[model samples]
Target: MSDGIPLIPVIPQALREAAHRGTLIPFVGAGASRLAGCPTWAQLADGALMACITANKFNHGQMEQIRHLSPRMKLSIARAIESEHALTIDYEKLINPFDGYQNNAVGHRVYRSLGKLSKTFVTTNYDAWLDTEILDPPLSVSTDSPVQDTVATPRVRRRIANVEDFTPANLNQENCVFHIHGSLVDPAGMVMTTRDYIRRYANDRGSDDPTRENRTLTFLEVLFQHKTVLFVGYGLEDLEILEYVIQKARQQFPSERPQARHFMLQGYFAHEYELMRSLTQYYAQCDIELIPFRRDQRDWGQLTEVLEAFAEAMPARAPLELQVQMEMESYLEP
Candidate 1:
């Protein structure tokens, strides 16, 4: 079945339908912000280079000639920061602005849409962009007032205190967001350092300590329980995340009975087929439908147009019953 619309390309029909039904949960990744003039991972590496030089930590020319490093080498750079003190400084400098993008407009739109759609959310981003966008007046739980009740609003954002806070009640709220890697404003909660990723994912087996536990798995469990996941910014590059997700998901659902539809917008075409193949195997024990989006230009106008069309074509069901009516109102109200 198609949406019967030509304006929107139904490249991934299943995903289109799910998005319309509001069953599609978006998993925003770094690439989503690139279009809005933000830096990509390679750019971040270059930023790391610049940061190293400005701090007088490393010889700029050492990395000047190097355009790109292999994935293994990048991982090594991340790993080296644990012991190499100056490199640690370079790592923080590189990641600080990387985390700062959360406050940008691209980040704002991403989170605002999530507030409009997904039943719940889990972002690996350490920035407060998503939380800031959805949290009205943007109150921090660590602040004096702590929680601001938004039960009356169309959208509500709540900060997950720790692993123990990932209960059904919190996850299923009208519009809830959980920052798995923590946020920038909350330095103690931030998980940018290589040591943090290593410690969190390495000791990921269920734990009694609330703070030390793997909230990623909890998030994934809630994610898998859902029918569809719309992965936005995730590129499946981080070893800790890729490995833990693959390993834990396999262990939890040893059988292929309960499967969830997984969607990812692919920015690079040459890597698409290979990445999809690997993802299929990584998620072998779990059932998943990989959706790849090819964007020659970074406009992403095509993708959004398709999403708008899909959202338009959604069946007149409970959640989406007012979609067309809203469209009409949008056209007529003003």
Candidate 2:
């Protein structure tokens, strides 16, 4: 089945088996949203900083200088804007233009391709695009807000506020969506600044700290350890999550090393052999298999075609109860 796509040289058999068995967990990143007209991280930061400069009648030269900086470096620009305006820019306000866009062709295709094979979707993006595509009536759980499960009829869609809301029973009940980062509805929870990342990931904090809780990181560790994580829309730039997975793997199997295989779909051109080879070796050390999609500059729909091909090759869906049981065991594993 994979032979149909000449562009993609190889698709791992393990990834196919995981998807067919409904054990594949999709870890969505910002690239997915960008396909739906949302700006990239760099663009989002630059746009907000530019707005701040314009509104305050600041020098255009500064805006241009900051615009050229990389996305991660732009945090400094955001800080500068805050210092000059004496006010923090609301990320939600900047993201307002992308709000209310419930449907996107690419998003719909992704959901359709995965079908009932996946019960849960995790994304770093703040957009509600996944809600539009996968969740009926668009339910979501945000790390920022709180949710209480009471003795009432379950709605078609729901949002979880934090890790406390996700019980083993709750996760196994039905399909769910998790916004590990802050969502659009709650801008304060969004991790945009350097300080936000530091606090969220506990960069300087001790693991035994009595006062701090890094629920998101803890959740990720468990997820990666158990699930056959299929990374979509991730550039593999964030080492924090990968590092946590590596740490847990080392701790669990110290003597006899076990391969913790994960998969990532990445876009690359023919000329970038060195780039591709370097990424392959890097992820290999982390026990990740990198699948490359040959992107033609003229063919915008190439990515969609690759995803569709993968969907076609996947085996028939498994029963819902069986799917839940398999996932549940991962959480219970010692």
Q: State TM-scores per candidate.
A: 0.62, 0.75
Q: Candidate 1 — number of clashing residue pairs?
A: 9
Judging by TM-score against the true structure, name the best candidate: 2
Report model 2's TM-score to 2 decimal places: 0.75
In the order shown, the candidates' Cα RMSDs to the true structure are: 11.7, 8.9
Ten residues in sequence with the least summed lDDT for candidate 2: 148-157
Worst ten in a row by lDDT for model 1 = 1-10
The reply for model 2, stretches above 4 Å from the true place, is 1-5, 8-10, 57-59, 76-93, 96-100, 114-117, 134-157, 161-163, 166-173, 203-213, 236-260, 297-300, 315-334
lDDT of the candidates, in the order given: 0.51, 0.61
Model 1 over residues 1-334: C-alpha lDDT tens digits?
Answer: 1222133334467765665665555665555445434566666656655555665655656664554674334434533533365344333344445454443444444444444545556666544445533433444566566574331222335666375676544544545567766654464555645566665555444566776656566556656654476666556564356556545744655654544567654343433556556764655434554444445443454455444343445421222545434433533442
